[model samples]
Target: MPPSLPSPSSVTRAAITLPILARAASTTSAGTAVTPNKPPPSKDHHVHTYSPEAFPLGYTVSSTHAGIKKKAGALDLGILVSTSDTPCSAAACMTRNVFKAAPVTVTSELLRNSNGRAKGFIINSGCANAVTGKKGLEDAWSMSNTTTSQLPPSGAQSDKEGTLVMSTGVIGQHLPISSILDKIPELIRTLDDSPKSWLDLSKAFMTTDTFPKLRAKTFKIGDRLIRMAGIDKGAGMIAPNMGPPQPPHATLLGVIATDAAIKPEDLQNALNYAVDRSFNNITVDGDMSTNDTILCLANGAAGSAEHGGRETEEKMKELTEKANPEEFGIFKEQLREFAEELAQLVVRDGEGATKFVTIRVKGAPTYEIANAVAKSVANSSLFKTAMYGEDANWGRILCAVGYTPLSPNPISPTSVSVSFLPPAASSNTTPLRLLTNGEPEPNIDEARASEILKEEDLEIEIDLGDGNEEAKVWTCDFSHEYVTINGSAEEEEGWMYD
Candidate 1:
């Protein structure tokens, strides 16, 4: 639920600026097309895309903050209105933290107020309206209200185009809402449904992120085939949560749009289920944030009324409930796979990260304990530092396992088994110096370990040997460049681990 919105006075208005288009590639994929040695099945996979016509419900998206990362200059606010306003339906997942941002709080309320229906999103990045107390809350709402004043109500039984607002940047600072508000009119005047428009709106909401993250999928919900478009932003302060109801202190913001005809309740249910396995399951540094948010807006533009009125929603609900694993198994797998790809992009872009690390923990007391242990090890600065140094620090791995709270009783260090496989020719590997726990086989080679650490992808496995519990954690090796990029390390390059 959203906190009480302060009176409009809490927020002031700045003069409006003319909307200007940014110079970016019309392409909507996350970054320069990933050139894999062996590219996946489809070069242009469904994992990240934005087809202008995908959303018949049409959309109105815009950004007020950009150009900060470069500090070269500034541009006017951006806006992108879709081509249609058909009856829409959508679902979303958000950061599960208690000190939620003002935008997150207000969005939840708007979702309910609009009765689970919405038009699209309006977002800004330079300033995050977080922890500003009453003023922040009012400013977030004010953005929504101002957008509402300019756009027409989505034509539906609900005649209201639900507007969602999002923000990202420093926490606990006052947002320059007046500057954002001042540009609303110009933004509305230039709202075009162009590929460039989509790209600009996406680039507008970036903080430290280097590239834009987006995806599109067409799902067959009965006889209706609906297209879903989504965009997300996150580069630093990541460590998403699943077990806890509240997100850790890391934040992620996203906007999902679809042009399908479905009720809000149904949309919410489907979205919740999708997110549990998607965004909720991923973690980077084990830290969460106060500004995590993922919103979905459906305007029912496609108008597929197979199950007229509540009938369509009811039938889909029944099928979803029965969990006919075989019926929509294909759809489910695609959705899950798409989400994993999206989450991987987040890890690949971790701040100052150079080596992508995958930590797999097996033989734990329980799944819950396994994850806790995995995260404890993965998020450790010591462990990550060791990876960056290319040192096979087996002791840190064992130490992480030993500190895990999952053990029901005390267990000797001998209970655990750890191994370092030199990198395969096709893949990257980690250093294999045995620090502790396992005796180094007399034949264990040293040159092989060094060669393996040079690969771009690295994998590490820890066998707790305690129970059957297991978990997987994704992370990156800490390098001095990371410190330099983040302005944390005093020297231009990071110190050597050795």
Candidate 2:
């Protein structure tokens, strides 16, 4: 947002200048054709997604308010536990911010010490436990220890390496450790595998989200049925660049639990693969969070108790091709669909968001170029505002594409083309081209384009006419509600998060 806007009390969804598009492109402007990677598969190739009604095997959830949130009655604490007799294999991605929140540091350490195994997650809303120095670290460790200590022997022989912690809210504030600690027992007492409890657990850890986000999938390796479920929360600070306990990540908190037996190495591989096409591919405000973390736990409850899941997810050395054991391929595809669904939910629930925008950049020489161009457009405030207003302003979208930094091989408008495709979920396959092969569509249909913009979901198709590689990004349109939400945020005396 610019520093010089007049009183906006009366205005809603006003167009605000964004910094990214303000600067001139280092290369030829988007007016020229440029390169991007490949594009999304045709609609027929869309992943077969599902809405599982049952909970993932062996996991139960409990949630309660512990006065952590400033709002009274706001459920602020949650526990997601795996009751399998043994510690479940785990894989996690955390924020790479230099000033990582206390919980992120502690959870990452526990996963390391336990060698990618854990009981479950203990999360709190309100204080982020970031930048509080040593005290924050101690509180975070205690959060994990205290929550796991009360549970039966499971993931870790000791409680210290059992539970993971996730915290979201305001930064630089200390959590009321005593109060949060006191309520841990109550949370455990209320834990159950009921559907409502799982939903409650999702909302309890949310900050600015207007609704809870969760998804489920059930598939079998051979004849053994395996179930997976995922839950996540984020409305702002949601540009996730997470890696496997590596540098760079998102403050967007998420968990995908499955009862498919898999090795620790394979579980990590699955998470790394799905995240690239899922959480890491979506954005809200483009601000990476200090507390961002995504954890995947496989407790193997679907298999016999004596030996865990009957179908062990074999570790695949290469994910881009078919696995030697065929079954791993099926598991990877299902995992990708599940992760993508959870990530899309965040964009759909973006703070003050009005439109869900899908950007596909195709024909670039490399994945890096395609991803960069897609993000350039996805993060543009100007393009988002245009979508919010339902404006058929193709110029804003083109301008955003033009400004991407592609030195040494700058974009040339002659071969570049742009179009608004029919809704991805719709049966329509035809695209309404605004520009084709570097020339504006001679017979463009303005009314049809306008109709496309009116739809809640829209897809922008850009082709560089360069190569076969491609990339996709999912984002939402910023609106008047966005400015009001960020502009009006004020920390009260007692409330910390949100």
Candidate 3:
């Protein structure tokens, strides 16, 4: 692990009390969940707030200048620990890339062996330790074992503290193990829970991200207050399509810690649902990373029947058919919203990207088709370049839709319509139709089109005019800076393993 660690400098509202969000199923991402913009049905506006910046109870993070990056004294190696005495429930969505990083392979086994329980995890940014074959795997194990050595161990040899590992940056390179392991004890000794610590930790793990990406959510399980916080880093080699401890993962990279009590199976299910709708729905440059991983740990520090910072060991109900659906629904939505916020941050900070675009493909025959078409348009280099130049090149967008292997046969060029939606907070209620029924508009409002595309954030709406199924994907525009950065990356000391 060589590239990143979170350096947290977050602000927490001690008085913050989040309102209850409704449990009813609604329409949104992947054509199933609630829309990212839709607020909870509750009259109160506090049901969801994006950046509470508070770490959940019982979690601590720290990073050190491990010299993993080429930059002198840059904080690289970091550790995030679930400090509860009991083994914390853990779940992950890992990259589907066949050339999985050494850390990824080791962490997968750790989770598999521990049965969804873990204590602490470590991440490094600099050398990805990918494509190094057996020796790379050994280094990953060393990273895990070294981390386990610092923290108190958990049950069973198969479950040795669940010391998961993650790495990012230059591919096919060996980690400076001695240089990193020397700092592991110091990282542990300096572990902290301060907002500044979280901010620093967030920044440490970042590669090309201009700013640290982190968010927090709060809710109540009965009278007990539950909190969820997440931090992630990635500015390139993104487009996470992770599975539930299966073939793939997303976000490029993310770590979520929560105090909400949940069962192992329920935790896995919630992560799968949230990730598929959020992280899996985004693409920046359409590149999949070998080390992409998102791990969620719940220490249950604020479980029911607790107060004054004391965590109860009492078993809480896991989300299941036998449990309360409302509470479970709220948990899943909060998790999704948290992941979505972080995932969006990845796009907003995409390397050399100047615009964040949302592609909404509606009236499709199926959710999969809608998703595929939307991603196809979002990932089109021509379309992205057009957006970069503030050009309403709607043909480029539609052409992207034309070649989709998953497209419907009836969806001829004439079967679709394309429009540029107004930017967020803009007063314009009407969309500027660039192409309607697959025909270019007779009188193009070039001025208005320029105005819409000039904004830093843009929205593209495509109507297949086929069926009710719809999907939304988030992406960024291509720019000359993207090329410049990639061109000189290797000489600059490191580049992400795409």
How many residue pairs clash in all the candidates, one count each?
28, 18, 36
Residues 14-60, model 2: lDDT tens digits: 21321111221133565652222122112222122333345677788
Candidate 1 per-residue C-alpha lDDT over 1-498 given as tens digits, one digit per residue, 9 for 90 to 100: 012211222211110121111211233376542211221112122234456655433565544433322254433245444435344454456666677778877877776666665556677766667778889999988988887777765444354545677777767567677777887776777777555566677667566566667666666655555565666777676776522122223257666665554456655655565555456545555668777776655554443444222223222332232354443444445455556666666666666666677777777777666666667678777677766666554556655655555434443445556655544655444445342233434454555655555555677767666799787777876666555655553121212100
In candidate 2, stretches whose alpha carbon ends up further than 4 angstroms from where it belongs are 1-53, 155-160, 247-250, 304-324, 424-429, 491-498
Instruction: Put the candidates in TM-score order, highest first.
Output: 3, 2, 1
Worst ten in a row by lDDT for model 1: 11-20
The TM-scores of all predictions, comma-separated, are 0.72, 0.83, 0.84
The 0-to-1 C-alpha lDDT of every candidate, in the order given, reads 0.57, 0.75, 0.75
Candidate achieving higher lDDT, 1 or 3: 3
In the range 219-312, model 3's lDDT, one tens digit per residue, is: 7767667887788888788888788675323127889999876776788888998998889999988888888899999876775534633456
Arrange candidates by lDDT, highest first: which order?
Answer: 2, 3, 1
